[model samples]
Target: MSTLPLLGAAMTVAELEGLQDFILSRDRDLELQDFCELGALDADWKPAAERAKALLQGYKGRLGIHGPFWGFTIASGDVEIQKVVTRRMRQGLEICDFLGATQMVIHSPYLTWDYNNLDNHPGRKAYQNFLDYTHATLDPVIAYAEKIGVTMVVENIMDKDPDIRRILVEDFNTKALAVSIDTGHAHYAHGSTGAPPVDYFVRRAGNSLQHIHLQDADGYADRHWNIGEGNISWAAVFRALGELTSNPRLILELRNKSGILPSVDWLKARGLAE
Candidate 1:
């Protein structure tokens, strides 16, 4: 049985510094999401990175990053768009290097509408086009990440099923590329796009599963509520995760910093963590 450490997603540098004691007290890790956005890698990042490093000094837990996903698609078919996306991702990798983060989470380019529209095309050609574009877009980014020793984990946002995501990771066939499942996104996909249950993602990713965003949703929208505050099936999800040979980092991606401790307590009370 592979057990994963509980992690907290700090949306800002100040919040992470404020909660440093609380996070380390529970032996949890940190996944910094603030610097992973576009335009965030500017001059201000230097000071923020310094502050984060100072705050995390002597912290023994592993670190991860939620890479930039807004305003960019890594699998864009347009060359210019792909270039911009890759540029932002390369910046994200620079931040990862600064923080010594081993794993970086990126949004998967598989959209539900795009996948569904494949039926309108002739005989998997649309699928092939998507694959080709994704490969073209991500290959350079993956190469850079490998050079810096950062594992790029593509997360599911609009994917209605695991097949596309699984295929995307396997197609790369590199150790630097893997899958990340955001529980709230999976729940939303299930309700809005008829996606498989949340457990299906864990089961399908299996060994390739490298990261997780553990949040609860009402199954209608991405609520990002604390665990036990919504309708997600925690027991089923953890059961599936227990079968994985690889231990994926599980981060509590709550909407606010205040929910972090309560969410940790909630998981402990339910035996999801120690």
Candidate 2:
């Protein structure tokens, strides 16, 4: 048995309802993104949380959760919005505790639109303000996550370069704070922002790279196709990953359940995963 970094796929609660055998048979870990949405957080999250716990009843492998991000901005200029984001994320951490999830993925709020507008304001001052605001909003959540022993991995969503995320993770300077690189997002950033190739994210985050959403994309949209269905250089990307000293969780984040096994088979055939 090869002890390669745990390979898995993202799944919703609905998707896993009747597909436990199909999912657990192929992957060693599950990145639960369904419970991270706003609607699921309503009603004290009781119903959803109970369902999630039931779903993982007998599975022994690791579990991860993607934190609530849609319509929420952790680094927003609006104070009320920041409050809502923190509240929802704290709920996410609570869910992590209930599910025994050691890692949780939070999407980075950094956006190219904000970066572009920075020039109109002042020298790096605007960017610095954004970082400060983000830290202030997430500091308490990060503290709680640390206390609960959950690694809060921030995933790159709209970052033009890895520097912004690297800075955010390094500023916290804690084992609990790390980066989650999404291959499809990196490819999109490369095309949209002229950022470095997808592998650069791995190299830049290095040991701090704690999680990965491995998916293929056509450099234009977040297609989330099967591993070999897009143009990303998997060999180069995996080569960079192989150099990392940290054993990051590699979760194939295909958009559809149908693409999961094919993605797994693609990697297994190339000896990239066990």
> Among these predicted structures, which one has the highest lDDT?
2
Candidate 2 residue runs with Cα over 4 Å from true position:
22-27, 117-123
Write the residue-wise lDDT of candidate 2 on 1-274 in tens digits.
Answer: 7754447778887787866876567547788887776687875666666787787777877788888888777788788887888888798899999878888898898887866676787577887887888887788788889888899888989888687787888887888788899999999989878878899888998988989999999889888998999999987888898999888888889887788878778877887774
What lDDT would each prediction earn against the true structure?
Answer: 0.82, 0.83
Best by TM-score: 1
Give the least accurate 10-residue stretch of model 1, judged by summed lDDT: 2-11
Runs off by more than 4 Å, candidate 1: 1-7
Sequence-dependent TM-score of model 1: 0.94
User: For residue 104, what is the lDDT in candidate 2?
Assistant: 88
Per-model TM-score, in order, reads: 0.94, 0.91
Candidate 1 lDDT score at position 206: 88
